[model samples]
Target chain A: MNWIVNNGDLIGQLVVAHLATAIPPIILSFFLSIPIGWFANRFQVSRGILLTVFALLYAIPSLPLFIVLPLIIGTGLRDPINVVIALTIYGIALMARSTADGLASVDPDVRQAATAVGYSARSSFWRVELPLAGPVLLAGIRVVAVSTISLTTVGAVLGIDSLGALFTDGYQRNIPSEILTGIVVTIALALAVDFLIVRIGRLLMPWSRIVGAGGGRSARRQRTAATA
Target chain B: MNFLIQAFAFIFDPKHYGTANGIEVRLGQHLLISFEVLVIAALIAIPVGYLIGHTGRGRAFAIGFSGGVRALPTLGFMILIALGVGIGLGAPIVALVVLAIPSILAGAYSGFEAVDRRTVDSARAMGMNELQIVAKVEVPLGLPLLIGGLRAASLQVIATATLADYVGGGGLGRFIFAGVQTQDYPQMLAGSILVIFLAIASEILFSIIQRLVVPAGVTAGRPKDVRVKSSRSRAALG
Candidate 1:
């Protein structure tokens, strides 16, 4: 308890640092995945290969990745950029898979209609296909967000100020209160971020509500409404 | 003969096999801890997921909640919880529960959502209550999806459980972490191999369960017929 009271500012610093390390990777992953997903969709390459590569990347434990990153970048303990790079590798894998899945799930007839209406491929993707695939893509985004939030902790062990610093400091000193403070703060952050993502998803994909209802009545109503 | 002797010697080494600081490093303990956490997470997650998937409001909540939960890093959560909870295995257990819940819920929800409405209606017309319908109709139909979710969750739990060793909780993670600390590449490789093997074994087991539990009727593509009958009944009811 005394430790937390004495070093409270450090806790805040850690939280900010963790966020700094996490956000960029997530944003970059979103951008990178867009093209990868489009490429996968346009070409008839084996999804099996794509998924396997992604899964392998996802499964590579964070600790080893963090260790490997510094060797490649030649930065020692001073910078958190390598941590971000390592974390982003995982994010790219996830986001790309999600992007591919979302695009694939887009209705074929909708694509056909867009092409029939003289919409170019780029416009159709941006305007029509992307909008319809919003729900699935958002679902993928949610997963990536959660994963990035979690992986940010690994950055702590590398001397980046974040929630993990609290855990490491508390562990090294055997200060239970300091550790507790960090844990509580981290969980709160996770929950808060998750809530925001859900809210955003709901706002972006209002049609999901009707789909959520999941019965013949809702389905029939949706079909009739669409035709009308 | 020299290579064979070295391998045997390494395998039988007391330092490799047992306690350095009064902690057991047996393979069984790791399996036990993982099994306990997986079974408990599944038992809780599957039923909750089923209920949520069956209802509209519940589905919304589950999807949102699960997404939120998945965003949390398991290692960080475990470390944090270990601090508050005062160390030992409890922290990792809680972390695993949190980690496993999202996949299980998502899996179960999707499974129920994908159920053929006609089959559900037939079960309903046959006078099955909600519980019966879920047990006899929804669950059987949703088995494959639910199994897939469980398989994914279990593998994740096993992999993440390696981190449990960080907080004095024993598992295969101890080998990996300790091996890294000492630069013992062989031990790290062995530990990773064991973890991967466990994950693959669990996947095979779940696949078998899925095969056994999914009803032959649903597997035969009877949902189309069931849908027609269900539509007629729903219209009549309306």
Candidate 2:
């Protein structure tokens, strides 16, 4: 108790730093993935290669990625940039898949109708496709958001600032409370962000809500859509 | 680059491969922890998951539970437990098992859920009991997903198990952590390469098992586009 209280200011600073390290990559991936995903979906052959490569990247463990970043980027061991850049790479991999999956979920019939109604290919993507893909995209973002927050805690071992710092501090000092606090705070942050994103998704995709709330066969359909 | 050459050299050097502190022992330790945890997790998760899937109850609970399990930062949990448990094998093994149970549970239940209602009905019409239906119909059908959950759980456990060194448990992670401490980047890279290789190898192994076990009809009927693991992955509520 005294540890968290006495270190409240320190914890606050670490939380801010944690957010700083985690949030940008999500934003960056959200923008970058649109083109990346578009290109992947556009070229069916290349999609396999691109997706495989990113999934491979995703398979690389977090600590090793952190360790490897300095050698690749010429950053010092403690550079916050090391953590940021590594996480950004992960975020991109995650978001790109989501974007591709989201884009693919768009109904071809809908696209044909939009085209028949005088929408250009470019505008049709922005106007018809992107909006419709919002729910799954949001689902993907929620995943990236939660995992990224949790992963930033891993950054502490690399000496980048974050809630993970508390964990490291706790480990070194043998204070379980500090580590407990870090775990609690990080989990709470992730859950809150996930909830907020889901709410936003529900708000944006009111049709899902309408269909879900409707009677008969809708329940099964909703589950299929969810699991799909 | 010279780094890659050096790393490959370090990895292949005979000196790194034999003895208690060597790669062999480390790999064994790593696999041992991963294996034990996976066994433990399967025992717990599979039954609960199978029951839920069979009964068609607790769908919401299963979703939330899986998310909660995955959202836990494994490193944090391991280290926190290590503090109390004094950095022995106890902490890491428990932590890894905890990290593993969700996917297995989700995979098991979802697999059962995926069994067609009519298939079970016909079996019942033929006078087969519930146990017979599960053993004969659902098990055969759900085998692929059950394997998938195992595959997913194993991959996760194996990859993350390398972090065991951080908690003072022995594993392949020793190379990465030790190399970092000594500024031996090549050794660290080599450790990472081994980790990646292990993951890929296991993935291949699981894919083969999935192909072998899944009913021929299931594979022939469906394209490989379903998101059984990732979708059930539940945005992993932090």
- Candidate with the greatest TM-score versus the true structure: 2
The numbered model that scores best in DockQ is 2
After TM-score superposition, the amount by which residue B83's alpha carbon in candidate 2 deviates from its true location, in angstroms, is 1.9
Output the lDDT of residue A42, model 2: 94
Deviation in angstroms for A194 in model 1? Answer: 6.2
- Per-candidate interface DockQ score: 0.20, 0.50
lDDT of candidate 2 at residue A156, scale 0 to 100: 79
* CAPRI-style docking class of model 1 based on DockQ: incorrect
**Candidate 2, A94: how far from true, in Å?**
3.5
In candidate 2, what are the lDDT values of residues B81-187, reduced to their tens digit? Answer: 99888887889899888888888987788788776666677899999998998888877887778888898888888888988888888888999888878877888
Could you list the CA RMSD of all candidates, in the order they appear?
A: 6.5, 4.1
In order, what fnat does every candidate score? 0.24, 0.44
How far is B200's C-alpha from truth in model 1 (Å)?
A: 5.1
Give the least accurate 10-residue stretch of model 1 chain A, judged by summed lDDT. A219-228
Model 1 interface DockQ: 0.20
Task: Give the residue spans of candidate 2 off by over 4 A.
Answer: A43-47, A202-211, A215-225, B217-223, B228-238
Reference-based lDDT, residue B105, model 2: 87
